[model samples]
Target: MPDYNGSVDYLKKAALRGSRLGLERISELMERLDNPQNRVKTIHVAGTNGKGSFGAMLTSILTEAGYTVGGFSSPALTGITDSFRINCREITKKDFAEVMTEIIPHCEAMEDKPTEFEVLTAAAYLLFFRKGCNISVVECGMGGDTDSTNVLCFPLLSVITNVQKDHTAFLGETIEEIARHKAGIIKCSRPVIYGGTDLTVSDLILREAKKKCSEFYSTDYFRVSDTSSDLSGTEFSFDGMGDFRMQLLGKYQVMNAATVLTAVEVLRGQRINIPDEAVRRGLEKARWHGRFEVVRREPYVIYDGAHNPDGIRSAAESIELYFRGSDIVLLIGVMADKEYGLYTDMLGSRIRKAFTVTPDNPRALASDKLAEVFRAADIDAEPFDDLAKGVCSAYEYAKANGLPLIALGSLYMYGDFMDALNNITE
Candidate 1:
């Protein structure tokens, strides 16, 4: 808990303390930051998947409409700690250092030192408020009810992207329980946008929204058509709205875009004046780092941080759709908390060969453990010492074998993979 003044080492030092899930520490820290979250209008987004990309899309459109946008995303696509961004740029090291300096003593003065996530959340809002952004798009770090970001009152909109079964240990095991946690973001009277396909989960959300009398807009209620995905982006047609395009690929984004558009329409009805041009521009510019990100050309290296089974299945489907008929070699690493058998079962049946490695996080599942899971499934999983060596070996194997390759499993692997990939390119 040292002062964070303008040191490039702020993250390295702060990151050392590591992640501990829970929001009481963050709630306390934010109170010391003058609760900047309340000063700005916010669009609170939470779901099992696609919420991050949806948040990116929301920020993009809000920015295009000339709003100074503040964004806070978790598990930063890269390892840069405190991926708090302002006006669409990652908070610079100097800014991070300065803000940490400002908030540290306040955090220390509190009952206890703030947890990393709490400090980061407080820093994001304080920095955004200081930078003078009109609105912020905040993605929940974990569940919604007690989530640190949930402190925002009167968020312009609460977006529940999609609820799926992940984080069963902390959140809940049943879909209803998971939905309840996500639906907790719905303010008493604020507009709530629901954008996912699971009926059981969607039903839980709708039930909550009705109980609160919050207006709900769902993709199932919208008339969407002519959706297409290519490497460039996705092109789609809407019912009330005509043609719209987004830089993000896959059919799933069409629903995500619909959710964004639905929120925009609600905002417009409330006299927000978000022009169609802004909406189009926002969809075009939305850039989330790791979801089905194509990292290389020539041999077509792709990266997807699909740690859970639902995510892995979705990524696999996207692969079959986008890179159909191409033989695939997968490079994988995952955390210990996830359901390994389910995840591997969903992905193993799709790819030709698989390679396993453990991520750098202490919570990571050992490579041998992952190998055993795949092997039991009759998959020939080659275990590597670590992510770096695994990725290198996989890349070489793919090169020698002349097949398309995919690197996935956990977002924790992204920083190392991205760093390694960059080094290779350089």
Candidate 2:
């Protein structure tokens, strides 16, 4: 293949490189490139859910501490060319093109070409190193053990946000087995900060972390803030961090905040010197879009990409707590791989009018199928063929009837909703 050095061209080449879901190719590629991951401190994260949100919070806090932080997040929330980012922005198109040009020859030199994720990760490691970041926060794209991002053997710390059942085709069937995959991000010598969850699956993660010689810190060690969820934002106070505020909504975010705070304490022991003020500031400034993100007001519009049972439960709680008695109209779309009935059953009870549609992905479940799930639960659900049409129908229903509408389900349709709202982030 030609050495493509433009953003669009590079992405085309990247697409042509098929998926190889193993770390061996990435290990060899990074090794040949002088292991740039070793040149800087890193906070590696892995989990079935909340990895993106937690990573965003950690990046914000670390940046507030006056550190130049580079981050590599999977399934990009924005940008098309690269899966890597620096200071919350995607790597520049020119930089991505240049890296692709350099990486092509190296791939050709190998006995076999590197997979798409592996090549992108290699480029990111080099980019972050060259950018002079004090640290990098990396989120594993899949499970940790065989994930390409696991190449870093001695990160400054490892974080497993919260493991649940997802990616069963690769990770495993049960929660304990899934936790093992997520816990693979932990290294023997590094410290691990884990979010507190009530699952025995969480216990498995703790056990694995201890077995690996990690200094594991759990939320049980800290006093969690009781946060109130509202459209304006979430508010809570802790013993040490004092009264903290966040623009992010949801009670689950309060748990994420606790995890971030615990991590700050762990980093402080290594003399990172992140003050309590920084923690509060970081929580306020951290933005992870599409998690109960409010896109419009005056007959409000809320967008949440709750794709699983746990995520749906959290979304349901946030809506009940904040938007109670507001006539909760819902615009829903979901993926084929998810347990649609479970999510719909949980969310159906709260929805005043539920409009179901398929997202942009080929893997999207049919809207009729989703509507059937809602109807099975005795919800008055309607089906729309397209996302834009469904959104319009929901908006019209809300506008005519004077109710607030929530557009949610799969993240695949989130971009569509955001675009329809003139591309605003929450």
Best by TM-score: 1
Name model 2 segments beyond 4 Å from true: 1-13, 16-19, 81-83, 423-426
Q: List the residue pairs that clash in candidate 1.
A: 6-97
Q: Which portions of model 1 miss their true places by more than 4 Å?
A: 1-23
lDDT of 1 at 295: 78
Q: Compute the lDDT of residue 104 as modeled in candidate 1.
A: 68
**How would you encode candidate 1's per-residue C-alpha lDDT over 1-426 as one tens digit per residue?**
333443335445556666666667877777767788899888899988887778888888888999899888888767454477776777776677666678767866876566666767887788888889898989998879878788887888899988888888889888888889889999988989888878887788888999998988776534788878887778888778678887776546677788878888888876787888888888888887888887786577888878887788888888888887777888888888888788666776666778898888888988988888888888778998667777877777778777778888888778888877666541
- Identify the leading candidate in terms of lDDT: 1
TM-score of each: 0.93, 0.92
- Candidate 1: residue 97 lDDT (0-100): 69
Model 1 poorest 10 in a row by lDDT: 1-10
Model 1 accuracy (lDDT, Cα): 0.79
For every model in order, what is the number of clashing pairs?
A: 1, 0
State the lDDT at 112 in candidate 2: 71
What would the per-residue lDDT of candidate 2 be over residues 251-274, giving only the tens digit for each residue? 678878778877888899978978
